[model samples]
Target: MQITASTVSLTVDDVAASQRFFTTHLGYAEQAAAEGFASLARDDVAMDIVLLARGTEVLPADQRDQHACGLILAFTTTGIEHEEKRLRAEGVEITMPLREEPWGERLFQVTDPNGVIVQFVEWATPPAAENA
Candidate 1:
Protein backbone atom coordinates (compact mmCIF):
# COMPACT_ATOMS: atom_id res chain seq x y z
CA MET A 1 0.00 0.00 0.00
CA GLN A 2 1.03 3.60 -0.60
CA ILE A 3 -0.19 7.02 0.31
CA THR A 4 -0.26 9.66 -2.42
CA ALA A 5 -0.48 12.88 -0.35
CA SER A 6 -0.98 14.01 3.22
CA THR A 7 -2.66 17.12 4.60
CA VAL A 8 -3.13 18.54 8.08
CA SER A 9 -5.94 20.95 8.84
CA LEU A 10 -6.58 22.93 11.99
CA THR A 11 -8.95 25.50 13.39
CA VAL A 12 -7.87 29.09 13.75
CA ASP A 13 -9.47 32.19 15.20
CA ASP A 14 -8.45 34.41 12.32
CA VAL A 15 -8.17 33.03 8.82
CA ALA A 16 -6.40 36.04 7.34
CA ALA A 17 -3.80 36.16 10.11
CA SER A 18 -3.04 32.44 9.86
CA GLN A 19 -3.00 32.67 6.08
CA ARG A 20 -0.59 35.58 6.18
CA PHE A 21 1.75 33.79 8.58
CA PHE A 22 1.92 30.64 6.46
CA THR A 23 2.24 32.47 3.16
CA THR A 24 4.76 35.09 4.30
CA HIS A 25 7.04 32.98 6.46
CA LEU A 26 6.61 29.43 5.22
CA GLY A 27 6.24 30.18 1.46
CA TYR A 28 2.82 28.55 1.22
CA ALA A 29 0.79 30.08 -1.57
CA GLU A 30 -2.80 31.05 -0.95
CA GLN A 31 -4.95 28.54 -2.77
CA ALA A 32 -8.44 29.49 -1.63
CA ALA A 33 -10.21 31.71 0.90
CA ALA A 34 -13.73 32.44 2.01
CA GLU A 35 -15.53 33.90 5.02
CA GLY A 36 -14.86 30.83 7.17
CA PHE A 37 -12.27 28.74 5.36
CA ALA A 38 -8.89 29.13 3.68
CA SER A 39 -6.23 26.98 2.05
CA LEU A 40 -2.51 27.33 1.54
CA ALA A 41 -0.12 25.30 -0.52
CA ARG A 42 3.57 24.74 -1.08
CA ASP A 43 4.32 23.21 -4.42
CA ASP A 44 1.98 20.20 -4.70
CA VAL A 45 1.28 20.05 -0.95
CA ALA A 46 -1.81 21.76 0.39
CA MET A 47 -3.67 22.39 3.66
CA ASP A 48 -7.24 23.49 4.05
CA ILE A 49 -8.11 25.22 7.34
CA VAL A 50 -11.38 26.46 8.68
CA LEU A 51 -12.27 29.21 11.13
CA LEU A 52 -14.63 28.13 13.88
CA ALA A 53 -17.43 30.59 14.17
CA ARG A 54 -19.94 30.41 17.05
CA GLY A 55 -21.95 27.25 16.65
CA THR A 56 -23.14 24.12 18.45
CA GLU A 57 -21.11 22.09 15.96
CA VAL A 58 -17.87 23.60 17.21
CA LEU A 59 -16.06 21.27 19.61
CA PRO A 60 -14.16 22.63 22.59
CA ALA A 61 -10.42 23.07 22.39
CA ASP A 62 -9.74 20.62 25.21
CA GLN A 63 -11.63 17.89 23.41
CA ARG A 64 -9.59 18.43 20.30
CA ASP A 65 -6.40 18.42 22.35
CA GLN A 66 -7.18 15.00 23.78
CA HIS A 67 -6.54 13.39 20.42
CA ALA A 68 -3.03 12.86 19.07
CA CYS A 69 -3.40 15.51 16.41
CA GLY A 70 -0.44 17.85 16.51
CA LEU A 71 1.83 17.73 13.48
CA ILE A 72 5.34 18.85 12.65
CA LEU A 73 5.77 19.70 9.00
CA ALA A 74 9.26 19.41 7.60
CA PHE A 75 11.06 20.86 4.60
CA THR A 76 14.40 19.62 3.30
CA THR A 77 16.83 22.14 1.87
CA THR A 78 20.34 22.03 0.49
CA GLY A 79 21.17 25.41 2.06
CA ILE A 80 20.22 24.84 5.66
CA GLU A 81 22.40 27.63 6.98
CA HIS A 82 20.96 30.11 4.53
CA GLU A 83 17.40 29.20 5.45
CA GLU A 84 18.17 29.30 9.18
CA LYS A 85 19.81 32.69 8.81
CA ARG A 86 16.94 34.04 6.72
CA LEU A 87 14.34 32.90 9.22
CA ARG A 88 16.37 34.22 12.18
CA ALA A 89 16.95 37.53 10.39
CA GLU A 90 13.18 37.84 10.01
CA GLY A 91 12.74 37.26 13.82
CA VAL A 92 11.12 33.82 13.65
CA GLU A 93 11.32 31.90 16.92
CA ILE A 94 13.52 28.81 16.87
CA THR A 95 12.43 25.94 19.09
CA MET A 96 15.55 23.91 18.37
CA PRO A 97 18.96 25.05 17.23
CA LEU A 98 20.63 23.37 14.29
CA ARG A 99 22.41 20.33 15.63
CA GLU A 100 23.50 16.86 14.59
CA GLU A 101 21.48 14.01 16.01
CA PRO A 102 22.62 10.52 16.98
CA TRP A 103 20.43 9.25 14.17
CA GLY A 104 22.78 10.84 11.62
CA GLU A 105 20.83 13.94 10.60
CA ARG A 106 21.29 17.69 11.07
CA LEU A 107 18.02 19.45 11.84
CA PHE A 108 16.32 22.38 13.54
CA GLN A 109 12.74 23.22 14.43
CA VAL A 110 10.49 26.28 14.74
CA THR A 111 6.98 26.82 16.00
CA ASP A 112 4.54 28.97 14.14
CA PRO A 113 1.76 31.07 15.65
CA ASN A 114 -0.71 28.20 15.51
CA GLY A 115 1.56 26.01 17.66
CA VAL A 116 2.64 23.82 14.77
CA ILE A 117 6.30 22.92 14.61
CA VAL A 118 8.13 23.21 11.30
CA GLN A 119 11.37 21.32 10.87
CA PHE A 120 14.22 22.13 8.48
CA VAL A 121 16.72 19.41 7.79
CA GLU A 122 20.02 19.15 5.92
CA TRP A 123 21.48 15.69 5.72
CA ALA A 124 25.19 15.18 6.19
CA THR A 125 27.25 14.23 3.15
CA PRO A 126 29.60 11.30 2.79
CA PRO A 127 33.26 11.89 2.04
CA ALA A 128 34.29 11.70 -1.63
CA ALA A 129 36.03 8.53 -2.78
CA GLU A 130 39.79 8.73 -3.33
CA ASN A 131 40.93 7.84 -6.86
CA ALA A 132 43.17 4.73 -6.96
Candidate 2:
Protein backbone atom coordinates (compact mmCIF):
# COMPACT_ATOMS: atom_id res chain seq x y z
CA MET A 1 0.00 0.00 0.00
CA GLN A 2 1.10 3.56 -0.64
CA ILE A 3 1.23 5.71 2.45
CA THR A 4 -0.11 9.22 2.12
CA ALA A 5 1.32 10.80 5.31
CA SER A 6 2.51 10.21 8.82
CA THR A 7 2.23 11.79 12.24
CA VAL A 8 3.23 11.16 15.83
CA SER A 9 0.63 11.66 18.54
CA LEU A 10 1.89 12.63 21.95
CA THR A 11 -0.03 12.92 25.17
CA VAL A 12 1.18 15.79 27.32
CA ASP A 13 0.20 17.67 30.42
CA ASP A 14 -0.17 20.90 28.47
CA VAL A 15 -1.00 20.74 24.80
CA ALA A 16 -0.58 24.47 24.25
CA ALA A 17 2.88 24.47 25.74
CA SER A 18 4.11 21.77 23.36
CA GLN A 19 2.30 23.47 20.48
CA ARG A 20 4.07 26.75 21.13
CA PHE A 21 7.43 25.03 21.47
CA PHE A 22 7.11 23.28 18.11
CA THR A 23 5.89 26.35 16.26
CA THR A 24 8.40 28.70 17.80
CA HIS A 25 11.51 26.55 17.73
CA LEU A 26 10.94 23.73 15.26
CA GLY A 27 9.42 25.44 12.20
CA TYR A 28 6.10 23.69 12.51
CA ALA A 29 2.85 25.50 11.76
CA GLU A 30 -0.46 24.81 13.38
CA GLN A 31 -2.58 22.72 11.06
CA ALA A 32 -5.55 22.31 13.39
CA ALA A 33 -6.41 22.70 17.05
CA ALA A 34 -9.18 22.20 19.58
CA GLU A 35 -9.73 22.68 23.29
CA GLY A 36 -7.45 19.82 24.30
CA PHE A 37 -5.69 18.89 21.11
CA ALA A 38 -3.47 20.38 18.42
CA SER A 39 -2.11 19.20 15.07
CA LEU A 40 1.17 20.68 13.86
CA ALA A 41 3.01 20.15 10.59
CA ARG A 42 6.09 21.28 8.79
CA ASP A 43 6.27 21.83 5.04
CA ASP A 44 8.48 18.77 4.66
CA VAL A 45 6.86 15.46 3.96
CA ALA A 46 5.80 13.24 6.90
CA MET A 47 6.62 15.73 9.62
CA ASP A 48 3.38 16.04 11.53
CA ILE A 49 2.66 16.02 15.22
CA VAL A 50 -0.51 15.79 17.22
CA LEU A 51 -0.54 16.69 20.87
CA LEU A 52 -3.28 15.58 23.21
CA ALA A 53 -3.83 16.89 26.70
CA ARG A 54 -3.38 14.40 29.51
CA GLY A 55 -6.64 12.84 30.64
CA THR A 56 -8.43 13.96 27.49
CA GLU A 57 -11.49 11.86 26.79
CA VAL A 58 -10.52 11.29 23.18
CA LEU A 59 -7.80 8.83 24.17
CA PRO A 60 -8.31 5.25 25.23
CA ALA A 61 -8.97 4.85 28.96
CA ASP A 62 -5.59 3.19 29.55
CA GLN A 63 -3.67 5.81 27.65
CA ARG A 64 -5.56 8.99 28.53
CA ASP A 65 -3.23 10.08 31.33
CA GLN A 66 -0.03 8.86 29.74
CA HIS A 67 2.65 11.36 28.79
CA ALA A 68 5.26 10.91 26.09
CA CYS A 69 8.25 9.10 27.50
CA GLY A 70 10.99 6.64 26.59
CA LEU A 71 11.05 8.00 23.07
CA ILE A 72 12.86 10.69 21.13
CA LEU A 73 11.22 12.39 18.18
CA ALA A 74 14.21 12.57 15.90
CA PHE A 75 14.93 14.35 12.63
CA THR A 76 17.85 13.43 10.44
CA THR A 77 19.17 16.39 8.48
CA THR A 78 22.26 18.21 7.30
CA GLY A 79 24.37 20.79 9.17
CA ILE A 80 23.80 19.19 12.56
CA GLU A 81 26.27 21.48 14.28
CA HIS A 82 24.68 24.64 12.97
CA GLU A 83 21.25 23.50 14.01
CA GLU A 84 22.48 22.79 17.51
CA LYS A 85 24.06 26.21 17.80
CA ARG A 86 21.00 27.96 16.43
CA LEU A 87 18.82 26.22 18.94
CA ARG A 88 21.18 27.10 21.75
CA ALA A 89 21.24 30.76 20.73
CA GLU A 90 17.45 30.74 20.78
CA GLY A 91 17.50 29.65 24.47
CA VAL A 92 16.52 26.09 23.75
CA GLU A 93 18.06 23.85 26.39
CA ILE A 94 20.47 21.29 24.99
CA THR A 95 19.79 18.14 26.97
CA MET A 96 22.35 16.09 25.04
CA PRO A 97 25.39 17.86 23.73
CA LEU A 98 26.37 17.20 20.13
CA ARG A 99 28.55 14.13 19.79
CA GLU A 100 29.50 11.67 17.10
CA GLU A 101 29.54 7.93 17.31
CA PRO A 102 32.41 5.83 15.95
CA TRP A 103 30.06 4.72 13.19
CA GLY A 104 29.72 8.33 11.99
CA GLU A 105 26.33 9.30 13.37
CA ARG A 106 26.36 12.80 14.87
CA LEU A 107 23.45 13.72 17.10
CA PHE A 108 22.12 15.91 19.90
CA GLN A 109 18.89 16.23 21.79
CA VAL A 110 16.60 18.89 23.22
CA THR A 111 13.63 18.68 25.52
CA ASP A 112 10.35 20.44 24.91
CA PRO A 113 8.24 22.27 27.48
CA ASN A 114 6.19 19.14 28.10
CA GLY A 115 9.34 17.00 28.45
CA VAL A 116 9.30 15.55 24.94
CA ILE A 117 12.78 14.64 23.80
CA VAL A 118 13.63 15.84 20.30
CA GLN A 119 16.87 14.75 18.68
CA PHE A 120 18.65 15.80 15.50
CA VAL A 121 21.10 13.61 13.66
CA GLU A 122 23.38 13.66 10.62
CA TRP A 123 25.02 10.52 9.32
CA ALA A 124 28.42 10.74 7.75
CA THR A 125 29.62 8.38 5.03
CA PRO A 126 31.24 5.32 6.55
CA PRO A 127 35.00 5.12 6.27
CA ALA A 128 34.84 2.03 4.08
CA ALA A 129 32.30 3.66 1.80
CA GLU A 130 34.40 6.77 1.52
CA ASN A 131 37.34 4.69 0.32
CA ALA A 132 35.27 2.70 -2.18
Candidate 3:
Protein backbone atom coordinates (compact mmCIF):
# COMPACT_ATOMS: atom_id res chain seq x y z
CA MET A 1 0.00 0.00 0.00
CA GLN A 2 1.22 3.47 -0.82
CA ILE A 3 1.13 5.81 2.15
CA THR A 4 0.24 9.39 1.30
CA ALA A 5 0.59 11.10 4.64
CA SER A 6 1.49 10.60 8.29
CA THR A 7 0.09 12.07 11.46
CA VAL A 8 0.55 11.65 15.21
CA SER A 9 -2.61 12.00 17.24
CA LEU A 10 -2.07 13.01 20.83
CA THR A 11 -4.68 12.93 23.56
CA VAL A 12 -3.95 15.88 25.84
CA ASP A 13 -5.62 17.39 28.85
CA ASP A 14 -5.58 20.84 27.27
CA VAL A 15 -5.92 20.76 23.52
CA ALA A 16 -5.59 24.52 23.22
CA ALA A 17 -2.33 24.53 25.10
CA SER A 18 -0.83 21.86 22.86
CA GLN A 19 -2.24 23.59 19.84
CA ARG A 20 -0.63 26.89 20.76
CA PHE A 21 2.70 25.20 21.48
CA PHE A 22 2.82 23.58 18.05
CA THR A 23 1.60 26.56 16.09
CA THR A 24 3.46 29.27 17.97
CA HIS A 25 6.73 27.55 18.69
CA LEU A 26 7.10 24.72 16.20
CA GLY A 27 5.88 26.59 13.08
CA TYR A 28 2.94 24.31 12.47
CA ALA A 29 -0.08 25.89 10.87
CA GLU A 30 -3.55 25.12 12.07
CA GLN A 31 -5.23 23.08 9.39
CA ALA A 32 -8.42 22.55 11.29
CA ALA A 33 -9.76 23.00 14.77
CA ALA A 34 -12.87 22.52 16.84
CA GLU A 35 -13.81 22.85 20.46
CA GLY A 36 -11.52 20.10 21.69
CA PHE A 37 -9.52 19.12 18.60
CA ALA A 38 -6.91 20.63 16.32
CA SER A 39 -5.08 19.50 13.20
CA LEU A 40 -1.68 21.05 12.52
CA ALA A 41 0.74 20.80 9.65
CA ARG A 42 4.05 22.19 8.52
CA ASP A 43 4.95 22.58 4.87
CA ASP A 44 8.57 21.59 5.36
CA VAL A 45 7.68 18.42 7.24
CA ALA A 46 5.78 15.40 6.03
CA MET A 47 4.22 14.55 9.35
CA ASP A 48 1.10 16.26 10.63
CA ILE A 49 -0.27 16.38 14.16
CA VAL A 50 -3.69 16.09 15.67
CA LEU A 51 -4.55 17.11 19.20
CA LEU A 52 -7.57 15.73 20.98
CA ALA A 53 -8.86 16.44 24.43
CA ARG A 54 -8.36 13.57 26.86
CA GLY A 55 -12.07 12.97 27.19
CA THR A 56 -13.02 13.62 23.59
CA GLU A 57 -15.51 11.07 22.25
CA VAL A 58 -13.81 10.97 18.85
CA LEU A 59 -11.27 8.62 20.36
CA PRO A 60 -11.96 4.96 20.98
CA ALA A 61 -14.05 4.31 24.08
CA ASP A 62 -11.17 2.74 25.96
CA GLN A 63 -8.64 5.35 24.89
CA ARG A 64 -10.71 8.45 25.48
CA ASP A 65 -9.64 8.76 29.07
CA GLN A 66 -5.99 8.12 28.38
CA HIS A 67 -3.45 10.89 27.81
CA ALA A 68 -0.23 10.87 25.89
CA CYS A 69 2.61 9.88 28.18
CA GLY A 70 6.02 8.27 28.08
CA LEU A 71 6.51 9.49 24.55
CA ILE A 72 9.25 11.56 22.98
CA LEU A 73 8.40 13.21 19.67
CA ALA A 74 11.75 13.86 18.05
CA PHE A 75 12.92 15.72 14.97
CA THR A 76 16.27 15.26 13.26
CA THR A 77 17.44 18.70 12.30
CA THR A 78 20.30 20.99 11.32
CA GLY A 79 21.48 24.08 13.24
CA ILE A 80 20.38 22.57 16.53
CA GLU A 81 22.27 25.16 18.55
CA HIS A 82 20.58 28.04 16.77
CA GLU A 83 17.24 26.38 17.23
CA GLU A 84 17.91 25.90 20.90
CA LYS A 85 18.90 29.53 21.32
CA ARG A 86 15.84 30.74 19.45
CA LEU A 87 13.57 28.56 21.55
CA ARG A 88 15.17 29.90 24.69
CA ALA A 89 14.67 33.47 23.49
CA GLU A 90 11.01 32.68 23.02
CA GLY A 91 10.70 31.64 26.67
CA VAL A 92 10.61 27.93 25.95
CA GLU A 93 12.23 26.00 28.73
CA ILE A 94 14.93 23.56 27.80
CA THR A 95 14.35 20.39 29.74
CA MET A 96 17.67 18.86 28.68
CA PRO A 97 20.78 20.78 27.84
CA LEU A 98 22.59 20.25 24.56
CA ARG A 99 24.97 17.33 24.68
CA GLU A 100 26.84 15.04 22.34
CA GLU A 101 26.78 11.29 22.50
CA PRO A 102 29.83 9.05 22.07
CA TRP A 103 28.42 7.90 18.75
CA GLY A 104 28.30 11.51 17.49
CA GLU A 105 24.62 12.32 18.01
CA ARG A 106 24.01 15.82 19.36
CA LEU A 107 20.66 16.59 20.88
CA PHE A 108 18.57 18.60 23.28
CA GLN A 109 15.05 18.23 24.58
CA VAL A 110 12.14 20.40 25.66
CA THR A 111 8.90 19.52 27.38
CA ASP A 112 5.73 20.96 25.94
CA PRO A 113 2.94 22.32 28.06
CA ASN A 114 1.32 18.91 28.27
CA GLY A 115 4.59 17.17 29.11
CA VAL A 116 5.30 15.96 25.59
CA ILE A 117 9.02 15.59 25.21
CA VAL A 118 10.22 17.12 21.95
CA GLN A 119 13.83 16.42 21.06
CA PHE A 120 16.00 17.84 18.30
CA VAL A 121 18.98 15.85 17.12
CA GLU A 122 21.90 16.36 14.79
CA TRP A 123 24.89 14.24 13.84
CA ALA A 124 28.16 15.70 15.08
CA THR A 125 30.22 13.74 12.59
CA PRO A 126 29.89 11.40 9.65
CA PRO A 127 29.21 7.78 10.43
CA ALA A 128 32.37 5.77 11.03
CA ALA A 129 33.54 3.71 8.10
CA GLU A 130 33.25 -0.03 8.56
CA ASN A 131 36.52 -1.93 8.91
CA ALA A 132 36.63 -4.94 6.71
Q: What are the Cα lDDT values of the candidates?
A: 0.66, 0.93, 0.91
> What is candidate 3's TM-score against the reference?
0.93
Candidate number of the best lDDT: 2
Error of 3 at 41 (Å): 0.3
| Tens-digit lDDT track of model 1 for 1-132 | 898656666665555666777788877877677674666767754443343322213457554433213676677666887888888888897889998877557889887665667789877762232222
Residue lDDT tens for model 2, 1-132: 997889999999999999999999999999999999999999986469999999999899999878899999999888998999999999999999999999889999999999999999888774578789
- Residue 64 lDDT (model 3): 95
Ten-residue region with minimum lDDT total, candidate 1: 48-57
Q: How high is each candidate's TM-score? A: 0.69, 0.94, 0.93
* C-alpha RMSD for every candidate: 5.0, 1.8, 2.0
Per-residue lDDT of 49-114 in model 3, one digit per residue for the tens? 999999888888999999899898999899999999999999999999999998889999999899
TM-score of 2: 0.94
lDDT of predicted model 1: 0.66
Off by over 4 Å in 2: 126-132
Q: Backbone clashes per model, in order?
A: 0, 0, 0
lDDT value, residue 62 of candidate 3: 97
